[model samples]
Target: MFTGLSAFPLTPVTDHGIDEESFAGLVQRLAAARVDSITALGSTGSYPYLDRAERARAARLAVEHAAATPVIVGIGALRTRDVLELAQDAQDAGASGVLLAPVSYQALTADEVFGLYADVTAELSVPLVVYDNPGTTHFTFTDDLYTRIAELPNVASVKIPGVPADPGAAAERVSALRALLPASVTIGVSGDPLAATGLNAGCHAWYSVVAGTLPEPALAITRAASTGDATAATAESERLQPLWELFARHGSLRVVSAIAETLGLLGHPNLTRPLRGLPDHDRAAVTHVVQQLELH
Candidate 1:
């Protein structure tokens, strides 16, 4: 049911706790920009770092700020119960859906992954968007596995990254996946400014971090691409690529979170427990990109 662009609003965490004002501003800006929806607690939100309570609080506040826009919380946890609980919490907080990943610690066989999805889908009332970030999960969903996963009742979409990030290759991958997935299940693309190309290849929507800081430009690119205006979309994407590279340089989470923090946006700069702050060089790189983009 999602289309166009959905900005993954950064979860704001202050040293004390969730920073309501800064966090709200970011969501409100996206809402004002008319982004298709908003996703919270995704990989880019540093989901693994926050405690259960912090995550729920972030979801609740983000939903409130989102107004009529759909709020989908990303549930990436080691425990199925934790994932289910977070999904329930998201539902309770009025989330529109949950984007879930495979179990974190151990890779499961295709059957096991399907069964785990079955468990989570059974417990969640809201729609589930399967998040396939093999880079982090270290497990890629095979075409057959995705076909099976698509049959689950509540599963509505799959978020695949532009892993290799080459326009043509990514398009080929998306096209192949689209052929396998049920028409009802929307395919979402992440990473790279392939929004235009992905849509051309049948991606129903994009989960864009670019939209987080530059909603208008990001959406403009999506709209251009959606309308078959690749020339215009390509131009905007070219402008966005350098900033995206900055994030890529320091890892997605660090650059995205630090960008939010630098802009006086997000709540706390705290990452999940283990991952520390961005190194100074990387932090400066993000600042330079933001400034270069003139993203105020």
Candidate 2:
């Protein structure tokens, strides 16, 4: 099971295609900073925006740069075939695991949700990390359904969006869910700023979008919290709080990509093809937040 702070890098796209050079550089930087894991082509990575070929290239770049560190590939899509295809591609691309969101073509019943998971797991060779980011999928995961999915073969972890407003409560909920899951399975939170607090609350680890832009501070937060230094951890989290707010302030997947572009981490902010960039005002807001954080 992967644990601690795992950063999710933005998948930078140029006018032609995936910017492998920039993407690899970002992954190398994060690895050097000692982030626990990295997710290639995730929500922050703009998985939905990328075509299959681009997603594969991004995953391969992340795996290559991550070296021994675990690299998770986001494999959520509306179609089961697409999800399964991406899952297989991720495995072939050397991803250590895959993160899947429940099918959202329609409002799926719990049984349908469980079946979709089972189908994906059956086709997958690597361990699966189920994602419960309701904000994106428009469907929330019930604890009972998670318990059942955890019992399936190759289901090694669960990824829930950390309730950042009340991390303690989120952590408690994670701990309670852990009890229902198999002892071998890990509980991870996708809430970046709350990672330190979530770990303190018994979450085994976190998959964070903020880590992509600021690996040093993000890993510092993870280390401080994981090692039981609440004072240091809280301070680190506070420092990065400004960046976290950007995710909400700007909204959607575009903001994270925009921040990466402004930082010069990516060659271009062009996401996939049709997705737009941050407006001048929002870009100014993001730039201001970035300057405030002063992450190096």
TM-score of 1: 0.91
Residue 73 Cα positional deviation in candidate 2, in Å, after optimal superposition: 1.2
lDDT of 1 by residue, 1-296 (tens): 46788888766665676666877888898899999988887776767778889888889988999899888898878887788888888899999988898856776778878888998898878888999888888887888989999999888998877634466786788778888888889988887556666765657888887687568888878898888887787788888788767765676667777777788765455554566668778788888888988776
Instruction: Give the alpha-carbon lDDT of every model.
Output: 0.79, 0.81
What are the clashing pairs of model 1? 12-266, 12-267, 13-267, 13-268, 14-267, 14-268, 49-272
| Candidate 2 lDDT, 1-296, residue by residue in tens | 37888788877777878778888988998888878788887788888877888888888889888888889999988888899999989999998899988748678788888988999999989998988888778888888888899999999888878754476686667778878999988988776656777777777777887787677887787788778887787788877777767766666466777777787877555677677788888888878877777755
Query: Residue 36 CA error for candidate 2 (Å)?
Result: 1.4
What is the alpha-carbon lDDT for the whole of candidate 2?
0.81
Model 1 regions lying over 4 Å from their true place: 163-169, 266-273
TM-scores of all predicted structures? 0.91, 0.93
lDDT of 1 at 220: 78
